[model samples]
Target: MDFKVREVVPHGRNYALLRMMPVKGEMPEVEPGQFVQVEIPNSKSTYLRRPISINWADRREMWLLVRRAGAGTNALCDLPEGSRLSIILPLGRGFDLSVRGNVLLVGGGVGTAPLLMLGKRLVTLGVDVKFLLGARTTSDLLQLELFKQTGETRVTTEDGSMGHRGLVTDHPLLTDGEIDHIACCGPLPMMKAVAAIARSRGISCEVSLENMMACGIGACLCCVEDTVDAGNVCVCKEGPVFNIKRLKW
Candidate 1:
């Protein structure tokens, strides 16, 4: 389906928060960690559509927090408000929303996009939601005030320009022993470190993988991830979201 760009809000030089609406009907229901395969317009060098996480969604609007990683994303960020974009949405699996009790959401860089909707959904379900957001510097953090509105929010920046002076794993909350479940998305190393902490504490945890995907569906064999039970599976189809137990990590 084609969506019309409603607005583009730039966050410094590397990221843009795009507000879009369906060109025809109301927006479709999108799960927290699901993504959209967006076709970049007027890009000669780009072929495959970029898979972007569903940052947030409502009845009439959808948000995509995009990082300028390459030509495709840079073209997307450069789009005007009225530009039309073709998108295949609600693709891939999302975080399990059945969770309850004390839940902590950890994210880094652009990987933090999906957690906002997850936190909001969990909040509506009466789940106690908390966020541990990490970035390289204070300026790298996105949507702090919005996250605070959804839950108790914390931060960790490598430069110590934000909440805590180290990685998210170094934050004191991880050792507090009060969290029941953890949902994380970030760089592979960060997710692995967070998963290790969760494993040591015996806390249920899930991680969203940022695998390279040429096709958003499983056909391309571009985003395969080796799992404990499934062996190698396509991350774009089987999951962008998976429980720690299922992963070979």
Candidate 2:
């Protein structure tokens, strides 16, 4: 679907919130843990559409929380309202909402984007949701109030600028008691560490990979990850999200 940029709101120092509405057709179904490939217009240097995680989406609008980490994202952040961009959305399978119990959603830095919709989805289904967001400092944390609307929220910062003064894996909640499951998206190291903790406690875990992607679809095998079942699978299709049990690490 082609989406028109409705708003571009900056968040803190490094991130921006982009809100877009479908230009012609109805908005495609968007799921948490799924992403959209955004066409960056007027850029001769960058050819492939950038794959951005779907932050949150409603029937009429789609939200993407973009982190200005490179040239591609910088161009996206500079896009003005009323600009149009082509988007391929709701790709790949989202988190399994079937398992019901206290569930924790963990995100690091801008990785928190997809979890917003995931949290909202879980809340809509009446599941208990807890969010553990980590950043370098408090200023790096994005959209806390929004997450709070759906579930309990917590934070961790390396600089101790807010909440717990340590890594998210060090948060007492993970070891405090029984949590039925965990869904995490973030830096590779953080996701791996969180997965390790979940595995040790025998809690099922799902992780969203942020592997570099050129084509958002499976055709371009650039974003492949070595999995236990499948030797090398495209993270763009087989998953931006996958069960930890299916992963080698």
Candidate 3:
């Protein structure tokens, strides 16, 4: 689908929060934790569309939190309002919303993007939601105010610039609360550690993987993840989100 940029709000030196709307119709239904493949404009070296998580979506607009990690994302962040973008959206599976009881959503760095929508939906469903966010420093944490509005929010920064002075896995909430479910998205090491903690406690956990991808469709086979059930499965199709048990981690 084609979308037009409505606004570009830069979060820091490396991140931009883009608000967009469809060129011709109302926004389609998008599950939280699903992502979009954005075609980079005016970039010669970038071939594949960049995959970005759906930060939030409403009836008329969609938001993408993009990090300027490379040439493609840099170009995407620099796009002006009113620019047109080609996108394949709402791709990949998302976190399970059927969960109930006390739920914790954990994120690190740019991984915090998708949790905003997830928390909002969970709140509407009357599910108790809390967020545990971590970053290298306070500046690395994005959308704290918005996250707080959706649920109880906590923070951990390696630099100790905010909240707790350690990694999120070290947060007291993880060990202290009556957590019924955990959904996490972050660097592999962070997610793995969080999964381990969840495993040891016998709490249900799900994680979103950030595997490399060429095509956003299963046909490309570039984003295959080794899973316990299906061997090598495409993360773009089978999931970007998976239960910890299904993962070979």
The candidate that wins on lDDT is 3
Clashing pairs in 2: none
Q: Can you write out model 2's per-residue Cα lDDT over 9-125, one digit (the tens) per residue? A: 999767899998999867877777888888888886788888889998888989999999887888899898999988878788778878689999999999999999999899889
Tens digits of per-residue lDDT for model 1 on 1-99?
A: 999999999988899999999999998889999999999998999998999999999989999999999999999999988999999988999999999
Which stretches of candidate 1 lie above 4 Å from their native place?
Answer: none
Q: Per-residue lDDT for 227 in model 1?
A: 91
- lDDT for 88 (candidate 3): 96
TM-score versus the correct structure, for each prediction: 0.98, 0.97, 0.99
The clash count of every prediction, one per candidate, is: 0, 0, 0
C-alpha-based local distance difference test score of model 1: 0.93
Worst 10 residues of 3 by lDDT: 169-178
Name model 2 segments beyond 4 Å from true. Answer: none
